[model samples]
Target: MNQQQFSSSHIPGLDRFWAVIPAGGVGTRLWPLSRAAAPKFLHDLTGSGQTLIRATYDRLHPLAGNNIMVVTGQAHRDAVCDQLSGVAEENFILEPEPKDSAAAIGVAAAVLFEQDPEAIMGSFAADQVIGPDDVFRTAVAEAIATAVTNKIVTIGIKPTYPSTGFGYIQKGEKLEIEAAPSAFKVDKFVEKPQADVAQRYVDSGQHFWNAGMFVAPVRLLLQHLQSNEPELFEGVTAIARARVAGDVTEPMAEIWPTLPKTSIDYAVAEPAAEAGDVAVIPGDFLWDDVGDFAAIARLNPAADESGVTVIGETPRVYADDANGVVVTDTSRVIALIGVENIVVVDTGDALLVTTTEHAQSVKQAVESIKAHGDDDVL
Candidate 1:
């Protein structure tokens, strides 16, 4: 994963703008459907005929053209390459192991900075489902515009509910940047709150859902990384430098596993906000993390006859008065009768049956399986 893999010439309309997709995470909540070898990003959770990561690449292609880089685990190398075939082999920033978003995204910043010092990179999660391509691109345009001013900008989704699952971002005064009129100074970053506290924050009309989409000059991002976590910064920078020297195999194997495991929020965003060096651009578009089976049900349209949400390729499904999600990957006909808010996931080696009310606890089942030495299904 080095700059030498692709042409250095910038795309006409998207010069200096690089879109980095961080495609890590096993999505344990998704369990059987999403495995360590093939995470949620590799599946079409929305049943839209395209995988999540593929959709993400399509969404950002217009904004970045060929200036796209994906940071992912080495285990997913072949799968990611197949999905993102348009992306160059050198553009794929392969991580030796899971070290969290900081290392995943920091290495991308370092690589882009080494290749193009003036590069403004935007890191978007590869597993997120966002819609109305025009709206998302517009929001990203504003984020890029704000990032040009040397501020670390994040695209904040307008909260639709007081969700305890996602973090909240408090916005301060509106920024008057001509290119980004809807931008605002970030007041602070808040962790996921309790139900009551989340309600208050949402009612106050001052908070936005933290979607973890960051846009900043690669140099500025590295500078912040150096200031907050010098050891981690040194590790990623060394990898990037190695890439510049025409090889990253030695450095990646030696330094990657040793990098500190931390998200970009704690490594850079939160502190940058405290120092008044962060900004937020309102993301006025449909967005979903597709975190669990509940999200899967929400994303897929219900079957007309049975009112059930069915995903994956199945021979037949006979449902009578059933309402919920059913993810199948077998030839057997799934017949559900009088089930309410029930979730059924049938795979080759696993079968999960639960209700929507207990969707969040599906990860616990995965944990239990691990404890019982059942790693094959996992």
Candidate 2:
């Protein structure tokens, strides 16, 4: 709960680890800038002018060095490589097809295990923004120490509000690991709940926002895959075997289709709760998934009258607006005279006008674009 209480100095024998970033998602939620060809992670959403993937690589470089492996689809392989030129070429694991996070994790684990069977793997998303690097590093260090002796360890962010967008982890009694004093046994992994249910969870003071960051030993994770999801394990093993046999391209294409499109949460974390093999460490650092335009708006400096402006080619003019986000790419001047709680996005080819209340539903607009068969606009 406090700084001294969550320090990582107590953890000894922590393994120096590698990081796996799953950058293959087609982020439809962040459309216009995000498309099937170039997803959100490839875009510079920060307005600070850095692509999300580049920022993530910079953040991970300190602990994992050039050992960061990026698993992406064949379509985005070139773009991913271009963005991550600082990383070694061999570190990019190109998936021949997309099969969600489970398969991505499997591929990275297989590759890492082949090199160092005892290696601890820390996995992250390509589209997240975590601040206060020292705090994040400390949490990761604690997670690595915990994973070396546990089955799977996850970094859990303290819930700041009743958020419906994220999954929640129910915290159990604190576990006294040798290195970290604040690790808790995971009781349950709940999916996105309804508003009232989410409010109850927040009131309980025993829940955390599941940040989807995980750390685990290669062997232990492989064991869970073999025992629980054998089909996926077999597919992953075949891919690893093919890589060893010098037929790298054929195996990923062959095995990706066979693997189920499930998330690590449904396949591993949820099951681990029943098996009592999961632990949660409180992450006190500032973290956000940057899942939508509103989340991006929250990161910007607050303006007068609850207005947030992202300056670009077209300057934003807002008046008497409260809790609104305005973005424009066209040079055309746009002004909101009396609008409140609205999202006004002006692109040359397309324009998005919605309320902040429906920010998450922007994915529907992306679908509409796809339905119109306008891939360029999406």
Candidate 3:
């Protein structure tokens, strides 16, 4: 994909648009800091004292032109408000219940459509970090342009490593247009693969990381949802109609629980890929979803040895450790000795100790905590 093929008609009035940020996930892998009540998106992991949601909002504000919509569970409304106090109150779409991305994006699409049927909406994850704002803006502009003429347009990150943690997108035939230089007709979408398979994908040069960033016209999105996922579309449309009628808060809460819990990828993207209605734009910005501890470790400043400690308010003491991660609260001192490839996270009420290789199983650890009726720890 290149830049010349995309014309102004492809992304009409992109500068005047609203951005949808889905912040409803319980980041189980990053527990105990990322608890069910307060996910990773609300935490200040970067040590720069800014929450992830704040950083993402700041990064997208320029292109969104001060219009932003955040979709989150009702349980997280206060935190979402606290983090995004700068945004308008009406812009926050608090889900009455957790219905996953399919419902969340559907609701957002309905809201955007009501505002402007032709409006271009950029859907994003609250946990991702993309650098070089110019690159992101350019790619998003191209996506918006493509989305005007296409059903759905997604930003595909140029893979930097053979990472098995993310899904991949296979680029198909190029479009014969000068305005859309970086856009391609998507051939297929692949889920996370094994190490060998991921390596092959990386070597193929035809694959790109599915960044989960999307852009589309509000009417187009609703049409696709109505055609592909009638249940989700109907639920969200009812919510929108209820909001327009009166008493939005009560009806939203009552209707959300009845919706299905499915991801947008499974409900829409994959189906669109199979139906040949999706397109991909090569993303040039440095991006990271910050999905796990390993990704965090990689983003942290390089250490002389193999280990790195992320110190919060609490001081961390380390000795005889290699390739280990130690996270602690601000008030206590965490001491580590003779540990390698280990992760030690000390919350005020709970502690998690696991090997780096088993970090992905932290969700299981949360389940154990739940089994013990220690919801406070979680």
Candidate 4:
């Protein structure tokens, strides 16, 4: 609830930790409420009173202190700065355009390496909702400890269900790290699979949901990046060098767009795992990406006794035998009668009405809107 609450740190090597937040998704699956101008990270979807990005920063600040770095797109610069008040301007790495996670995290590693070669950088996406602060921080501390051994580390969430939506990390054996007791060698990374395969993964008890939270020493991360993607590594390093020398405007404009587009998982994590250089720490905490209306429904409490969840400043909503989620940014009164598992989001310019079962189809709707040249709403 307050910064002072999470300020104390007893974990070793936490002083050298640098938290890197990659905030670059459009979140098209949460359309209407989440758009190009304002992505899901900018919204408080969980009714927690803090924006997702702000909450993310709050969670990481205690571990990293003032060493938090946020890498985001150029378009959301002012909004991001407004939300993260105390973060230094120099700590914000603004990409001229979106180049996916590898470029964003790669450049941040390069920049932090220049500032502190011993920096232990942990990359967490800006939009994920993880909680019971203590548990999450503990896993991260273990990740930091494992990273000190010059191995790439990631905090994998202990699976709660057979979720076909998330990628899986197959943890191999216990890694003997004195500082990180729960560290395990990552055997392999698996793509999102069918329901039966997901069930098998969950049943095995050796697999964890890949939360995309990676921790590694800056120098080690750069070495893997250079080894795996030499061109991308070179480009990001040049931009980092330019920033240290003077203005990064020229170098960023020239190099950033040309960098190869890929995710850190594909570029470094998978390959590193194959080489037995990656470790996974099981995170026993609640986690969610808040991906769509269904996730929004899961995070918020029901409004009144009616089985409907309401968010934002909707004046009033009448529901009779209806169960669903409603997000309204306007004053319009909404009434639902006899409908089940419905989702209604009303922004001034766009209104999205869908069922929980059809939540993932919102992306298709967004694509149709784009095809119709409705960029104004987007």
lDDT of 1 at 55: 99
Predicted candidate 4 versus true structure: per-residue lDDT over 184-300, tens digit per residue: 999999999899999999999999999999999989889889999999999999999999998999999999999999999999999999999999999999999988999989888
lDDT of each: 0.89, 0.79, 0.79, 0.90
Local distance difference test, candidate 4: 0.90
lDDT of 1: 0.89
Residue 252 miss distance in model 4 (angstroms)? 0.7
Which residue ranges in model 2 land beyond 4 Å of their true spot? 1-16, 302-306, 311-323
TM-scores across all candidates?
Answer: 0.95, 0.91, 0.92, 0.96
Q: lDDT of model 3 at residue 199?
A: 92
Instruction: Write model 2 residue lDDT over 66-182, tens digit each, in one string.
Output: 678888888897888888987787777887777788889987887778788888898999988887867887788778778877558899998888998899999898888767677
After superposing candidate 4, which stretches have Cα over 4 Å from the reference? 1-10
User: lDDT tens digits, residues 1-378, model 1?
Assistant: 122322223222146899999999999999988999999999988878999999999998877889899999999999999999999998998888877999999999999989999899999999999988778887888788788888999999998889999999999999988867899999999999999999998898889999999999888888889999999999999999999999999999999989999999999999889989999999989999998999888888786867898887754778888888889999878999999998999988899999888999989999999999999888
Instruction: Provide the clashing-pair count of each candidate structure.
Output: 0, 1, 21, 0
Candidate 3 per-residue lDDT, tens place, 1-378, comes to 234422344456565467899998888889987877888898877666888898888877766756899998889999889899888988888876667888989899898777677787889999887777667878887777677675488899989889889999999987654556778989999999998999998899899999888787778777778888898899899888777676687778777888888888887888787788888989988998877776666666535564665646655555565556667775666666767766778887888888778888888878887998988777
Model 4 lowest lDDT segment of ten: 1-10
Candidate with top TM-score is 4
Q: Which stretches of candidate 1 lie over 4 Å from their true place?
A: 1-14
Angstrom error at residue 134, model 3: 2.1
RMSD of 3: 3.0
The TM-score between candidate 1 and the true structure equals 0.95
